[model samples]
Target: MNSILRITVCAYLLSGCTFANSEAMPYKSWRLGFSAPNYMEVWIESADVVDIKEQVYPRAMSGTAAIQTPLNNTGDPRGWPEKPGIGKGKNVTGADLPKKIYVRWQSLVEPQTYQMVINVPESTRAIMRKEEKAFCAFDGKWITDYRNALVINLAPGGMAKIWVMGSCLPAIEVTKVKAVVDPRGPYEGKSGGKYDKLSDQSKAYVEKFGVPYDSWK
Candidate 1:
């Protein structure tokens, strides 16, 4: 090939490699896990988002009293499952990992959805990439050996945390959201339109665990 043609071919090959790296996550499975004191739901807000659900274990089964599973489009009440998780898990492909997620849950007030950014610092990702089969300093109960994962954790009252396998990053309290309203559930109390406030009962739970994994608000 001529010098110009050789340069063109090398550039094309380099671009292809970059595309592959972005499309495939460095993990067996990437999970979208959320929890709360009550019911909640999480969905990918980004278009062309990757979903490799078949790669995740313990998929949702019909008629299982477990009530919460990845297939439920939800999170069961009272927090993360006794198992690894009760939310969505997939072997994402076709695009770069997303930087945000959507969380929906009903509190004393009607359910609202928040579109919040997921901030995973490079240092955190590096720790997860080299992580051994150990525990997450954040999600203590889960003893999973995740080498590298993109796990989103949505706490109640718009508080968000994330799990990158072995690391659970700090909380990102979300004050602004779309379609928020007043509390009117059976546990009805005045929210004054600020959805970030916890209900009377849920407040107690917060002190015990820094996790909002809450009424799923």
Candidate 2:
């Protein structure tokens, strides 16, 4: 082949090789895992403006209750899970408790550290005229609002686990959990104002879990 034609062919081959290499490399991903007693649900709000909602059933019923977030674009949060709710009278109590209840979250994105905020209320069960309810514990301490959430660094393809433990009886079921993403480091300055500007729920979360590192502006 002539010099110019040979040069063109070599360039085309090199471009193809570059494309193949890019496709072969794995992208960054974030994942969350947890296990509970009764039915559980998780909501993921990603940095890419996507929302994911997953519901996990009991192992005894479905033979599998492991839940994972869908890696797809959800335009609006309200449009997802429009139904009323789950686990009304179907609660498992006493010896009939579920065997397995696990939830997970996974996503592919730019490699960077992220943080997770979990809400574990103190005695979600309330009795009008009954005795006070007991709280759940983790790592030898009660899982209160102050100790419910956690912050961790996640590298590419890394996974963060949050083990949930509690009773599976009626009025004591594990219903919902919210997981927010801090694309920036947990200690980075806040994009918006300080805690005052956050939503009521967020404000409550701050009160319980404390503000993230350097998050306040």
Best by TM-score: 1
Cα lDDT of all candidates, in order? 0.35, 0.24
> How does candidate 2 fare on TM-score?
0.19
Candidate 2 structure quality by residue, lDDT tens digits, 1-217: 2232234334543553221111110112211222211111222212111101111222212111233222232111111122212211222222111111222222222212233323322232111112333454434443322111111211122233322222311132333333344444322333232211323443343344442222211
Which lDDT tens digits does candidate 1 get at residues 1-217?
2232234334544553222122344555344444333323323222122122111111211111112323222333454332333334444433234332322233322244333323334444345445355545656655545444444444445544444443343222222233222234211233443444444433443334334433333
Worst 10 residues of 2 by lDDT: 47-56
Weakest 10 consecutive residues of candidate 1 by summed lDDT? 57-66
Query: Cα RMSD (Å) per model?
Result: 14.2, 20.8
lDDT of the structure predicted as candidate 1:
0.35
In model 2, the clashing pairs are none
Q: Each model's TM-score, in the order given?
A: 0.38, 0.19
